[model samples]
Structure formats: structure tokens, C-alpha cells
Target chain A: MSMDFGGLRAVDRLDLMIHRGEIVALIGPNGAGKTTFFNCITGLYTPTEGDIHIHPPGGGSKRINGLKPNRVTELGLARTFQNIRLFQQMTVLENVMIGRHCRLRSGIAGAVFRPPHTVSEERQAAMDSYRILEKIGLESFVNDLAKNLPYGAQRRLEIARALATEPFLLLLDEPAAGMNPHETHELDQLILRLRETENVSILLIEHDMKLVMSLSDRIYVMDYGRKIAEGAPGRIKNDPVVIKAYLGEEYVA
Target chain B: MTPLIEIRKSVLVSIWFMFLTFPIMVIRVNTVENVVEWRWHNMIAIGAGSFLLSFVWRYMIRRKEQGIRRQREGAGPRLSIFQRIGQERRIFLPALTLLAVAVVVFPFLVSMYQVNIMTTAFMYIMLGLGLNIVVGVAGLLDLGYVAFYAVGAYTYALLNHHFGLNFWVCLPIGAALGAGFGILLGFPVLRLRGDYLAIVTLGFGEIIRLVLENWNEFSFGPSGISNIPRPGLFGVAFSLEAHARYIYFIVVALAVFTIFMVNRLQNSRIGRAWLALREDEIACQAMGVDKTRTKLTAFALGATWAGLAGVIFAAKTTFINPASFTIWESINILCIVVLGGMGSITGVVLGALVLVLLPEYLRAFAEYRILTFGVVLVLMMVFRPGGIVSNVRRTYQFEGPDSGDK
Candidate 1:
């Protein structure tokens, strides 16, 4: 996908492929267009060229170019934000419940009058959200406002919220931006467990090299709005281009 | 906590209060004689009283905060009275039942005048709830809500006046027209946010009012359709007292239904979508909530309540005019929503009652009603911006591990 901002190309002809259940990590220095690429895929921004093809688990692949952000989410692809864009005023459970927005089939009549079917569906959705919260170890903060949560928990809540959408391909943008070592370790295990148990694919953008190197099945490196290196952890760790552009000369020696 | 700092805070608060109260408390207008009288005695009394009150209040708040800080350092948590009431499940149903019974009995115990006032208050409550859906829940700042009210009122008036239809027939027609207008007005302003949305809505309201005033064809121009027909109770002609009581019950029932519907919506998936949209439009869209559909639903749902209230209002007054559905009317309804914490059903109810009835009780100062309202609203913004009954955080029955709903 190629994305241009007037004369500047934010993302320039970057091609990435993540197979089902594969943990892919997209790493780049600040302003290398990692987030811009994610934006292109998520429909937050329309790519100037190239197409975003989503192959749903049930089969059939479709080019999702110029679709709305909500349409992208409904196609079994969900993502968290780089800066933790949570519904700060809403409670934790409500935040997670919103993740089930596309899945639920309730309308105005269902919401206002609340027939038995709608009520049952609502209850089931609540239970599903609660279960997701429990899995993320945020059951304790269910009633707490999303803003009131501690930094680490808030990040986890965002992940839980995304997971509630039951996405086949989950994209996380800087999920470990403000986490401590312990929290990062916990997140690593959580991501691994999600892949193992749920068979979900994860594409994460991260600056934390240690977490990235440990969690990613494959690493794709980008710099100056272009992919510089793409390979397994061992191979990319020693790649000359990646070492010069990102990892630095010290790591290569 | 130095006395000097404490005194400085108190003085600042006093100065603020003095400026806020000066116009309303110190100056009295003699509307009958068309003269403004300066009440020096009243000014001095009020100024000194405010200063003293501010001093005491500042000291008390400081002491309370310090105490809370110390407690926070030592304890797990402490629930405030509001939180306690909000969380305690056992007390909730009984309290609600008592309030419900009181509401049913209120009209019978009060005088006819009081009953009429209460009915008006209920209408405002209904309007407030409707606006709350747009402003509080959907985070759409609509300044033209009275347009929908006007549509409903006009729908009823024109139908009853032109076709000789009864209130019952007009009621549904009014509601449908109200919803239709809501969607109609909502479409153009779908992409507008914040002040722009407010401006568009305000303009829409003025347009509706102007259309009613100048048309002279359908709405009877500015004179309005008189004798719009009062609602009947199964073919029985109600006397004056009975009529007041009758209107009171109808409005009360409508208000109760609105509250029930709003409350249910607040907890439902659609309610969550509206709130999410309000909280963050991008996030809501990312979560797969269709922006157009959600916004239109919010507008339609909110307007439905206002339309019902409008029909009731016309039936009770037995008259209508373009003058009644002004921008000020929209502001009055908006005031109730904001004054009663936004997104709170109970808050809107309390806000409507206080805003509508307080003016009636202050009949002696009736000339200063608008001035007093402005001051009160300003004070509310400064002190408790959330409102009189701010929205409490809600937890579903199925939230806890040992929850019976499981």
C-alpha cells in the first residue's frame, strides 16, 4: 500500500502478508510510517494505491479499499490505537460491550422496548464481554470508569475491548507503549495464549525491541517509508540493512 | 493549611459570589411602572451574607478535603452517600416504589393550580429526557430541539382545527410527524459536530418557527389554532379541577413511560452505541457503529418523546401559537437536561421540577424569574457542572462473580 500526504509519501509501496495464527510485528523508528500503513489497512485513511485484501477464515477474499472504518471492523478485523483511545467516561464493561457492536443485531425497537429476544441477546453479550474481561484479568475493574484505570490495566482493557469483537485478525498499534517490564511480560504471555487458544492472527506495531523480538513470529522492518528487511527473528536481527537503519551498529558487533 | 491562604480563597469566592448576585439580588425592576429601583438595603444584606457564607463554606471544604486525603492514605475506600445509594441493590427497589406511589398521590393532594404547574413540569421533564438523548447520550449538541416540539404541536393543532380530529387521533400523528422531522432535520447536519451542529439545529428551530408564523395557511400564522381540543377520559367531560387532574395523570403517565424507555435504552446495546459515539466518534466508528444510523436514531428517539410531550402540552393548554415554540423554549428544555445531570433520567426529572416550579413558588419575584434562572444556571456551571443529579456509574446484575443472573 502506498499513502501520500500532498508531496510527502507517508507509506510508500509497503507490502505485508500475515497468515492465519501468525504473530507479525511491524517495527520502524518514529515517523517511518508504521502507523500510517496500519491506518491504510483499517480504512482510517484511504491508500492512494494498492488494495487491502482480507481473507475471512470462512473463505473468500475481498479487496477492502475505500471502505469506512466501521466496515473494516465488521469484516473480522479489529485494532487498538497507538495512544489508547478508550471511552474514558464509560465503565470498563461498557467499553468491552461496545466491542460487540458489529456482532449484535439489536435496533431501536430492540433497545427501547426490549423484547425477550433482545434482552437475552443483551444478557449474552454482557456475559461474553465479562468473560473477555476476566480473560484479560480486568473483571475487578468492570464497574470502574475506563479513565480511572491504571496505565497498564487501561492498555489491557483496550486489548480486551478489541478481543471482544472476536476478530480473526487483530491489529495492535503500540500496545506496550507505556507498560512496565512486568506488564510487558504479562502481555507477551497473553498474546501468545490468545494465538494458541483462539487461533487469532496478530499484527502489532511496537518500539520495545525486547518485547518485539520475544513475541513476534516474524519481523518486518521499515524505514524512510519503505520496507528495509523482512525475515525470521535470527535472520532479521543480523541483517545489515536493519542494523544500519534501526538496530544500530553496536547490536551487529 | 495557613489561615492566610484560607482567607484568600474565601475572599475570592466572596468576590465571585458578589458579582454573580449583584444584578439579580441588588436591582429590582418595577415592570408595572417601568422603573428600575436600586435596593441598597437588600444589596448590603446579600453582599455581607454571601461573604460570610463563602468564608464558612471554604473552611469546611478545606477541612473535608484534608480529612479525605488522610483517610485515603490509611483505608481501602470509602463510599459517599451517592455511591452508597447507587450500589446498594436492596434499598433501590423500595425507594423507587415509594417514589412511584408518591407521584401517583401528588396530584390528589395538591391544589388545582399546583396540579397544573406539576403537569407543566412533567412536560419539561419529557422534553429534557428527549434532549438528553441527543446531547448527553449521543453527544450531539442540538439547540433546535423545540423544532420537533413545534412540529408535534402544529401537527396536533392543524389536524384538530382543520379536520375536526380528536386528541387521540392527533397524538399518534403528532409523534410520527415529530420523528419524521427529526430525521429530516438530522440528515443535513449529520456530519456537523459540536458548535456547528448546535448552530444548524438552532437555525432549524428558527426556520420551523418562522414557517409556522409566516405561512398563514396551515398553522393559522402567529395567531395559532385556538381550541385545539383537550383530551377526554372515555367520553366524560371533565370539570376545571377534574381537567387539571386529568391532564396531570396523562402527563405523569407519559413521563413515566418516557423514563422507562430512556432507562431501558441507557442499559441496552443501542444506548451503549450512542454513548460510545458521543465519547469518541472515531472509536465508535472503528467499533463498527454506523455513524449515520446511530445519529439518526438518537435524533428520532429524542424527538419522539418531545412530540408526545408537545401533544400533551397542546391538549392541556387548549391553545397553540408560534410564540410558544421559541428558541427560548429549546434553551429552557436544554437547561433542564444540563441542570439535571446530562445522561441521567432522575436528574432530568429533578431538574425539570426545580426549574419549572421554583419560578411559580417565587411568584413575588416573578419579574426577576429569567434573571434568577441565569444566575442559578451560572452557579450550577461553576459549582456542580455535572448537574443536580449527575449520572452515577452503573453495574449490571450479571457483573459480579456471584451474580444471580449467571
Candidate 2:
């Protein structure tokens, strides 16, 4: 996919892929179009050229270039924000329940009357959201407002909320951006467990080199809106181009 | 930060008071011949009164801060009496039940005039709740809500006047028409948000009223469709005082229904979508909420109750002119919602009661009632910007360790 804002190219023909049950990390310097690529794929911005496709586990692949953000999400792709976009006034559980909005079938009539089906569906959604929270270790803050959570827990809450959507592909934008070492370690364990337990594929944009090196099965490096290298962590670490562009030659040890 | 800065703020506030009070306070209406007269004494009185009020407010706030400091030092109660009352369910529930019982028995203990006023208040309560859905919950700023009210009232009035339809038959038709109008109004204004949306909605309201006033063939050209048939129980019609009582019951039932539906809608998946939309539209969409559909639902749902209230209002008054559904009516309903606390159902009810009944209670003040009302409203906004019954965030009952996080 390629995206151009006026005369400036934000993302230049980026071809990224995430297989089922794999954790793929996209690492790049600031302004290297990592987030722009995420935006294109998630339908926040319609790429000026090329198509982005999603292959749901039970379904066929379809082009999702110009689909609305919600429609793309409905197609089994969910994402978190770099700046933590959890609804601040809402409770943690409420935020996760909002993630379940697409899967639920209640309309105005069903909501008002709340027949047994609607009631059961709502209850099930709540239970599922709670389970996701528990998995992410945010079950204790279920009733607390998202804004009131500690920074580390707020970041984790965003992950739990994204997980509640039941997405086949989860795009996490800077999940460990502000986390300390212990929190980053916790996040690493969480992401690893997510793939093993939830059977979901993960794609993330990150700035932390240690977390990126530890968590990703495969790492893709970019520089100035172009992919410079893609390989296993061992190979990518020693790649001359990536070292010169991002890591620097002496720091490659 | 310091006493000097505080003093500077007080001076600025005083100047602002002078600027605000200069025009209205100086102008006087000569009632004997309906002539405009300038009253310097009145202006002086108002300026002085405003200055005193502002100073008192500043002093009270300073005192409250000192009290807070003292409380922090463990020299006094940690929370205020009002905050304690608010936090304690033991005191709150009984008070709420008493208020509910009082509302239920209000008509029985009062005269027909009071009952009539209570019925009007109930209609406002319903309208307030409806507007709350659009403005408070969905976070859409609507200034043309009276347009929906007008659509519903006119739908019933025209249908009854021309086709001779009963109230029951007209009610659904009116509500559907209102909802349709809601979608029509919602479509073009979806892209515009905040103040821009408010302006367009306001214009829509004016357009509706103007059309009603100009089209003599259809809306009777501001003369309005009169002799509207009152709603009945089965085939039996209510008489005199009983008519007010009966209409009161119907309105009570409708208000109750609005309360129930709105409460449910706020807690449902759709409701969460709305709250999310209100918080952050982009995030809401990214979370799989269809922004267009969600906003439209908010508009239509809010308009639905207003539509029902309009039908009852027409039946209750037995007549409605274009003047009845004015921009001020929309503003009044909005005020009730804001005053009661936006997005709060119980707040809307309390706001309507206080706003409507307070005026009736202050009828002895006669000409000065509006002046008092304006001052009270300003004071309420100053002291309680969140509103009288501001929405308390909902929390679930979890049997886990409670940390003093928030």
C-alpha cells in the first residue's frame, strides 16, 4: 500500500503480512511510516494506491482498501492506538464491552425490551470481556474508569479491550511505548500468551529495541517510509543495512 | 496562587459583572403606556447587587478551600455534609422513594391548575430525556429538537383535523413521522459537529416553524388546528378536573416508559457505542461502531419520545399553534436536561420538576419571577456546572480487593 499526503509520500508501497498465530513486529525510526502503514491497513486512511486484504480464519480474503474503519474491524481486524484511545470516562469493562459491539445483534427494539436473547447475549459479552480482562490481569480494575488506571495498567487495558473484539489480526500501536522494564516484561509475556491461548495473530509497531528483539518471531525494519530489511531477529540484528540505518554499526553487538 | 492574584481575579470578576448588567438592568418597561424608559437607580441597584453577589461567592469559595485544607490536616470532617449524603445509600434511597411517592400522589392532593402544571412538567421531563439521548449520551449538540416536537404535534393535529383520526391512531403515526424527520435532519448534519451542528439544527427548527406558519392550507396559517380530540380510555372520555388527572396519568406512564427505555438504551451495546462516540468519535469507529448509524439512532431515539410527548401535549391542551413549538421551547427542554445533569434520567426528571414547578411556586412574585429565575439559573451554572443530578459513572459490583485508586 502507498499513501501520499499532498506531495509528500507517508507510506511508499508497503507490503506487510501477518500469518495466523504469529507475532510480527514492525520497527522503524520516528516518521518512518509505521503508524501510517497501520492506519492504511486499519482503514483510518485510504491508501492512495494498492489494496489491503484480510484473511479471516473461517473465510476468504477480500480487498479492504476503502472500507470504513468500523467495517474493517467487523472483518476480523482490530487495533489499538499509539496514544492510548481508551474511553476515559467509561469503566474498563464498559470499554471492553464496546469492543463487543460489532459481534452483538441487539438493536433499539431488543435493547429497549431486552428479550431473553438480548439479555443472554449482553451477559455473554460481559462474561467474555471479563475473561479477557482476567487474561490481561486487569480483572481487578474492571469497574474502575479507564482514565484512572495507572499508566502500565491503562496500556494493558487497551490490549484487553482490543482482545475483546475477537479479532483474527490484532494491530497494537506502541503497546510498550511508555512502560518501564517490569511492565515491558509483563507485556512480552502477555503478547506471547495471547498467540498461544487465543489463537490470534499479532502485528505491532514498537520503538523499544529490547522488547521488539525478545517478543517478535520475525522483525521487519523500515527507514524513511521504505522497508530496509525483514528476517528472523538473529539475521536482522547482524544485517549491515539495518545496523547502518537504525542501530548504528558499533551498537550492533 | 497568592492573595494578590486572588484580588486581581475578584476585580476582573467585578468588571465582568458591570459589563453584563449594564444593558438589561438599565432598561425599564413602562407598563402604563408600554414605553421604554431608562432607570439609572435600577442600574445602580443591579450593579451593586451583582458586585456583592460576586464577592460573596468568592469569599465562600475561599472559605471552602480553607475548610478543605483544615480537613486535610485532620482537623475536621474529610467530606462535606452534602457529599456524605450523596455517598451514603442509606440516606439517599429513602429520600428518592419519598420523592417518587410525592410525585405519584401529587395530583390527588393538588387542585386542577396545579395538576395541569404538573402535566406540562411531565411533558417537559419526557422531552428532556429525549434530548438527553442526543445531546448528553450521543454527544450531539442539537438546537432544532423543537422541530421534531413540531412534526409530531402537527402530524396529529393535521391528521385529526382533516382525516378525523383518534388520538391512539395518531400517536404512532406522529411518532413515526417524528423519527423520519429525525433521520432527515440527522443525515445532512452528520458531518457537522458541535457548534456547526447546533446552528443547522436551529435553522431546521426555524424552517419547520416558518413552513407551518406560511402554509395556511395545511397548518391553518398560525391559527393552528384547534378542537383537537382529547385521548380517551377505551371509549370513555374524561371530564373537567378528571381530564387533567387522566392526562396526568397518561403523561406519567409515558415518562415512565421513556425512563425505562432510555435507561436500557444507555446500558446496552448501542448505549456504550453512544458513550464511546461522545468520548472519542474516531476511537468509537475504530472499535467497530458505525458512526453514521449510531448518531442516527441517537437522533431517532431521542426524537421518538419528543414525538410521543408532542402527541400528548396536543391532546392535553386540545390545541397547538406554531408559537407553542418555538425555539424557546427547545431551549427550555435543553435547559432542563443540562440542569438535571446531562445523560442522567433521574436528573432530567428532577430538573423538569424544579424548573416547571419553581415558576408556579413563585407566581406570587408575578413580574419579578422571570428575573429571579434568571438569577437562579446563573447561580446554578456557577455553583454546579455539572448540573443538579450530574451523571455518576456506573460501576459494577466486583468482590475483589478495593484499592483507593480513584
Candidate 3:
């Protein structure tokens, strides 16, 4: 689905489908509207015009055009902020646990009473949070405050938190935004593992072409909010429009 | 499980058990006048208990770490209770429920003076919890929450004194007025954040107070409003002949109700949105949290509680005054939120009770009381900046029915 802004068209008519377990990357230069497209898909901004459909594991597709972010998340779509949006004062584990908030059913009374069921539910959530933390290699930092984690770990913690939402489709806004080369490599591997092992379909916006090309099942290139080119990694890498819009024609060939 | 895990779990269980048992044990120890003297043996026993409790707590934390490690190694263990509860709502419900039970039963068990003190504490608790929602959960620093309290109190006082309206009738009106003012405050200041936001809120609070102080015709200026009607159950007024304890019970009940509702809102989708907003406003907006609505809701909810507290204050004292709802009162409530640990219901309650009661207990110190209070606050901030229970965190679980489990 492509969105058109007033004359400026931030996400110009782009058609894309990311099936379950696929890792898709949206890449472009600054003002490419990659983030805008992610926001549109995740219900952050209502596209000037486009239908964004999210089909959960169960046999149903949610027309998520105008839904609120939390509503979209509730419908099995979760995303990490471009900038880490962790409850900083909270511990790392707590950050991840907040993601499972959508799954918890106990109201105020149940939380206070700690009924047998509440206790069990809490136990399960904690376990799941830890599990996600482990998956992101953040188990060691679970008790540490979110703000105290290293830059790379903080990014991982954000991913862990998003995964905790149990979203069938995970939209990551620059998972490797501030990472070093080693951290980027690790993140690339983590994304692949998340897709292959967890079966989570991912839609990521990344500036790191090496990471994107290596990790994405398919690539969609955008500039000025409009799709410039879309194909396999190799094809997109060599596409004339993609090179001009993103890699710069002079730098490409 | 590894030995570390086993030891940690045991320690956690032990510490929790000790915490559960300490109050019961303390109940048996008789109070001497206003102070409880601890004999050497008692001190020793307390020390031992604390040591054991800490040991258990440490062990549980370590075990949790081990469990996490095992999971990373692809040998994850079964879910634990801590895992299920996660962190966010863990302390909220427990603290609220305990406070609820206490409030419900307090009138029956406590003395008149104690009941009176509890009523005031309950008011502060409500104010603190309300502020916690704005400043703690939403990460919006509001230094002017007491203005809402003042607006509520004055609204009720003016309406009831002039129109002969009952306290009950003015209560909702007071709350509405507070919320109105809250939204008004939210409009201009919502754009500002952090220290700037704080300054605006502070200025707003002072402006309200100044208006209340200057507006002689409406607020009676410095003399304040007096002879306010006390709340009655149905048509039955709480009187000495009947049972003044019932009035105390009513205030306590309101406190419990307020806590319950706040807790509910905090756990609901709104609460998560608040936290998300608190963590990152731009991101929250990016994630589809309507910034305007979330902020206004924070202001409205916070003001609603403050307004309700004002009603309770007016009724409890049978008097309303500008002095009672001052910026200092706002600071005190904020202190409770900070000292109790922001976004922590239990921490706020503990902070309120300690701050409110400590001065009363130190009344004999007279001149030194305020000084001591300041020192204590500084010391607490220095030692535990995150508040008394700062370790509490919000948690999430991903293993739902649709989890891509193998």
C-alpha cells in the first residue's frame, strides 16, 4: 500500500506483500519515507490513500489502515521505535514484559489479589519475557535498568520488547540504527534467527545495505515516499532507479 | 535447574515469606506510649529475619538469571510465578489490594486520632497516586497538581456555601471543574516537556493560588471558607452520637476506590499507552498513541483524583482553606511519588504514609521536625533515588496460543 501526502507523496503507490516468516527490508536515502511507510503500515499515520492489510496466523485479515498503534498491536502487529522507546527507569526485563501487557487479562482486582490464576499468568509472562530476553542475548541484563544497558543491548532490548507483544508481523524501525559493525552483524543474525526460528514475519527499515541485503528475503526501495524499485537483493542492487534514488547513479555504475 | 537457580528461588521464596510474616510478628510487640521500644533480643530477632529475607531475595534473583541463561542455551525451564506476573502490574495490584483491605477495616480497629490521621494520609495518597499517573506513568512532570485540588475544594466551597448545595452534589461539580482546569493547563503546556513542562505546571499552580488569594468575593481571600458540611451516608450524618468512625471509614473507602480505579487505568490499554508515551512521545505518536488524548487523559485523571480529594478534605474538616491546598502540599505529594518510586503504587502509598506520619510522630521535636523532615527526604533521595521500591519493572509474555512454537 502506498500513501500520497499533499503534493509531496511521502509513500508513493508501493505494492508489497510480506508472507509469514519472510524478512522484508525497505531501504532508501534520507526522506525516502521508509519510516513513514512503516508508520503507515503499523497505524501511526493514516495514509492519504492506501489499504494496509495484516493477516494474523488465524484465517483473518485485519484492514489496519486507520487503527491506532495499540489497536494494531492488539491485532498481532508490533513494532520497535526508530529510537529505542523503552521505559528507561524500568529494568530490561520490565521493558520486555510491558510488551506482553496486551496478552494479560487480569484487571485491577486480579493484579492486587494475586489469585491463583493471576500468579500463574504472571509466572508465564515473566518466563516469556526472560525467553525473549534470552533470544535477544539480553538475559544477562534483565535486572539492569533499561537506560544502563549498552547502546547495542538497548537496541536488542527494544526488539525483545517488540517480540514480547507476540506479533505475527514485527516492524522494526532501524534495528541497527546506532550499532557498530560487530553489533550490526549480530543484529543481522538475530533478525534471520527471529524469522526462521520464531516464524515472525519482519518488515525492517535499515540504513545498513550490507545487513539488509544479507538478511532480507526481498527488498523494496523507496525515495520521496514513492517506491522506486522492488525485486530480489541482487536485482534491486543493480536496478537503475534504485541506484539513482538510494545508492546514487554515479556510485552504482 | 542449576544449583544457582535452586538457591536463588529458595532465597526469593524465603525473603517473600519473611516480608509476609514481619508485620504479623510486629503486631505482637506492644507499643509504649507513642514509641515502640525494641529490646536487644527483639533487635536480634529482627536482624536475623532481615538477613534471611535478603538471602532469599538474592537467591531468587540469581535463580531467575540462571533460568534466563538456560533458556539462551536452548534448555529453557518452565514458567515461574515471577515470569508470569512480569513487572509492571506486579506491585500495583498487591499494593492496592492491601491498601483497600486496610482502608475497609481501619475504622473498626483504629483509634479516633489514628482514624483522623489515616483520613488525611488517604487524601495525600490519592493526590500522590494521581500525580503518579501524570509524572510517573506518563513521564510528565506536573508540579501544579495541587492547583487542581485547590480548584476542586474551592469549587465545592463556593457552590455549597452560596447555593446551599450539599457536599455530595458539589463533589462531581468540583471534579468537573478540576478536569476543566486540567485540560486548560494541558493545552499550552503539553507541547513542553521535562524541566520546561515542570516550570509551566509550577507557574500554573502558583497562578491558581494567586487567583484564589486575590479573588476576595469568590474565595473569601485569606479568611478561607468554613463551616462546610460533612458527608453523610444516605441521609445519616456521621456524628458522635452515632459513630464518627463511619466518616473515617467513608474517607478510607474513597481512598481505596480511588486506588482501585487508578490501578485499573494503569493496567488497561491507557496505562501502556501512558508508559509508551512516557518512554518516547514521538515514538508513541508514531505508534498511533494519540498524544493529545493520552495527555488530556493524564491531566483529567490526575485532576479528577485531586478534585475528589478536595471534596473529601472539605467534608472531613468541615472547613476549606487556601492554606490546606498549597504548592508545598503539591511538593509533598510529588515527594511521595518520587520517594515511593514513580509508577509504583506500593511505593507511593509507602511514601505517603511515611512522610505524613513521620512529622506527626516527631511533633515532640517541634522546631527540629521540619529540619528533620527535610534531612530525611534528602537522605532518602541520596540513598534510593528510584524510591523505596525502585526495582519493580513492567514485564511482558509472548507465549500465546498463536506463538510460532515448534
Tell me the docking grade of candidate 1. medium
Name the top lDDT candidate. Answer: 1
Worst 10 residues of 3 chain A by lDDT: A105-114
* Cα-based lDDT at residue B402, candidate 2: 31
For each candidate in turn, the TM-score is 0.89, 0.88, 0.63
lDDT of 3 by residue, B1-406 (tens): 6768756665566566555665555445555576654444544465566656666656666775776688778674454343344434877588658866876776778677877887778788888888999999999999999999998888778888889888778888888888888899999987899999999999999988888888998789878898887776678654662345766666666777877888767764567668878887765554435678789888988888898888778877777777776789889899899998899787788888998999988898989999999988886875567787664544332343244111
The regions of model 1 sitting more than 4 angstroms off are A247-253, B1-54, B57-98, B397-406
Query: Taking the tens digit of each residue's C-alpha lDDT, what string does model 1 give over B284-305?
Result: 8887788889899899988988
* lDDT (tens digit, per residue) of candidate 1 on A202-225: 999999999999999999999989
Q: Which residue pairs clash in candidate 2?
A: none
Candidate 2 segments whose C-alpha is farther than 4 A from its true place = A247-253, B1-55, B63-101, B234-238, B399-406
Worst 10 residues of 1 chain B by lDDT: B397-406
Count of backbone clashes, every candidate in sequence: 0, 0, 28
Give the RMSD in angstroms, all C-alphas superposed, for model 1.
3.9
